[model samples]
Target: MKDTNKHQGLRNQLAKQLEEKGITDKNVLEAIKRIPRHLFLDSGFEDFAYQDKAFPIAAGQTISQPFTVAFQTQLLQVKKDDKILEIGTGSGYQTAVLVALGAKVYSVERQNELFKITSALLPKMGIRPKHLSFGDGYKGLPNYAPFDSIIVTAGAPIIPKPLMAQLKIGGRLVIPLGEGEQIMTMLIRKNETQFEKHEFGEFRFVPLLEDKN
Candidate 1:
């Protein structure tokens, strides 16, 4: 119980950071507050959990910063019961955030090692999303098309076209575009034939790869 209190303290710090950074979405802030960032990170680095910096997790990938996670979730405009597709599960931290926001999450991870860790952690965290898949996230999940929101954790040179097509009309997809250094971008599917683009800010993320493991 005392440890839970410490966890809550970290969460409060995260909330304060988000609020100071102008993250006004109450739901997004709430999700950030509720998800345990420390638990998702390596035990050795648990002290840095709320420090607003990406930390290396199991795979070559790193867990995204709190602001980046909150920023993307805010841009996606998730609603309760909305179907969300997340590319690059990583530590399953963002997946846990999506679940906290009350979205039915479908997350895909390309690295076998990271996928395995996340699959085991989600249940431990009590964040049971609708589905978790191990594969190339660039393909998205065809079987569960027309998602209300989509978020890609890694940086892709180009937004995967199939992912755009998978968005429902008026749905939003938030992704990072570029190599090495990237800019966080959002795409709103205005209709079946068109999308509106918005550039949020610059961010750095691991490359979105196609490797099986």
Candidate 2:
């Protein structure tokens, strides 16, 4: 059985942080609360998993700060069992959160090491889904097109058109935009030829890169 106390404490901490930051989405807050953040990081840093800060993991990527995760996820407005395409699988933390929120997540990790580690870690955490892939996040998973939502974990110089095309009409895509420094961007497809874009705020994330693994 899972450790209820640790889970409760993490939930409380994340809830307080989200409230202080004005994250109003109850579903997002609860998703962050239920998932065990510690399980997503290196054992040495597990104690700090619930803190509102990023921590280094393999492949020179840092697990995103808790508040950022919650903020981006809140923007998605996920529904029960929605199919989600996650562009980056750093540490698999965000994927775990999506699964906890009842999403059927299909995650692609460009970093082979992270892909392997999380492939093993997620199942142990009871966050199993039918698909996990090691590939470039830019290409997306075309075979599973028309995802209910798409979340790009890394920063892109511009939104990749291919990834955008994968979204279902009325679907949401949350990605970090800009070249050097980045801003969290949300795009909702309005129709075959149109979308609505909103910029959140300045944020830091690893560059989205090409991969063939």
Clashes of 2: 0
What would you estimate as the lDDT of candidate 2?
A: 0.88
Error of 2 at 119 (Å): 0.3
What value does the lDDT take at residue 50 in candidate 1? 83
Per-residue CA lDDT of model 1 for 1-213, tens digit only, reads 123888888889889988999899999998888887888888888778888889999877899989899889988888899999999989998999889988999999988898998899889767898999998888999999989989999999999889998999989999999998899999989987999999977899999986554
**Model 1 pairs whose backbones collide:** none
Tell me how far candidate 1 lies from the true structure as C-alpha RMSD in angstroms.
1.6
Per-candidate Cα lDDT values, in order, are 0.89, 0.88
Task: Give the alpha carbon lDDT tens digit for every residue of 1-213 in model 2.
Answer: 345696688778878888789899887888787887877777798677778899999989989998888888999998989999999988988898888888999999988898898898888878886589998888999999989999999899989999899999999999999888899999999999899999988999989997644
RMSD of each: 1.6, 1.7
lDDT of 1 at 149: 87
Off by over 4 Å in 2: 1-7
Among the numbered candidates, top lDDT falls to: 1
In angstroms, give how far residue 67 of model 1 lies from its true place. Answer: 0.4
